[model samples]
Target: MFILDIFSLQQNIDFSLRSLTISLLLGTLLSLALKIHYQRFGMSLSNRVAFSKVFVFITLTTTLIISIVKSSIALSLGLVGALSIVRFRTPIKEPEELAYLFMCIAVGLGLGANQWLATIVATTIILIVTIRWKRSEDQSLFLSLDWEKSHNIDLDQLQNCLLKFICDCDLRRFDSRDEREEVIYYINIANSDNLLSLIQKLKTDFPQIGISFLDKTTIPGV
Candidate 1:
């Protein structure tokens, strides 16, 4: 009877290679779509192009691992143990990036469980909603300025310059030192053309000024 029980357990643990292969392929394609979506619509100020490169790999690997572990309770437990030892040090700077990663994992889990149709439909719907939400939200930008103290530029002069193209400008921070000065502002402009014009005007008037625009959702940085 023990021998027969062991044979049944072994048979239960055996999974179809064709199903695993199909799941992996689907995962790869979905991950690619996610990568493209993030690169285009994502609001993260980090190096998004470099960060998004991991989507495909993360999805495919998750699919493969889930497919293997789903066949047996012992394997699933072992997987949990193995994953607990792994450490990821790279920081995720924004909540948006973390949300995308969760989406990738969810896609892999659904496909790995052989719920392909449901996964595809749900992902499509979510991506569409994300696009609409982003479009409707107010987009504010953070502007950073740095220049040498030798330029003799003052805060009032900078505000005067900003008022020409920007209808609204709020000073966020100001730092001054022996030789260098830094200023941060929260500003709203209509379009890319306005941004370019502002940058050009700043450069023309104060050649030594350094300008950087950062996404308002993130910490203001160069």
Candidate 2:
């Protein structure tokens, strides 16, 4: 009889078991969608795999927490106190990443509070806008070059070459190690049409130097 009582208590539902299950499942699936969206459209320099993986966990955890505490003020306070002991040690390197993180958290909170309609509608709008903006716009890019200082590069000639191809070509990073020099510059190249020509010119003048664009990735279909 005692064993039966314990089993029955274990099976008891708090604030509708069906609702809890549905919210968690929906939140998890939404998080997965957002992860795919970010993976395809994110322009951050930091690799996104680590941060993207956390969305599902965060959403599910938040849903479960809210499910447990939604009915009582004391439980809510206890939840807060419990959460206060936790620490977020992972460093977010980009403001964009932070923005995305907050959005994911908001989704979890909304779903946890059982505001499914609001969460779904808002997430859909924001997701579509973000993807479209990233895909249709000219994203930011920088240029970097590395070569041996012994190569005797002419700064004036290089500046003239860059000026013909790009706007606001300003040197922002300069480094030297032993015999090699590394230089980074901010450049505005609105389109890829002139990129090959610029590369050809650079190669003609400095055949042995390494030249490449920074914060650039080969995102498929972007």
In terms of TM-score, the best-performing candidate is: 1
RMSD of each: 4.8, 7.6
TM-score of candidate 2 on Cα atoms, chains taken together: 0.65
* lDDT measured at residue 92 in model 1 versus the true structure, 0 to 100: 75
List, residue by residue over 63-126, the lDDT tens digit for candidate 1: 8888888889988998989999999898877788899999999999998888999999999999
The lDDT values for all models are 0.85, 0.79
Regions of model 1 farther than 4 Å from truth: 1-9, 146-184, 189-207, 213-222
Q: Could you tell me how far off, in angstroms, the CA of residue 100 lies in candidate 1 after the best superposition?
A: 1.0
Candidate 1 backbone overlaps, count:
0
- For every model shown, the clashing-pair count is 0, 0
The positional error of residue 28 in candidate 2, measured at the CA in angstroms, is 1.4
What's model 2's overall lDDT? 0.79
Per-residue error for 129 in candidate 1, Å, reads 0.4
TM-score of each: 0.73, 0.65
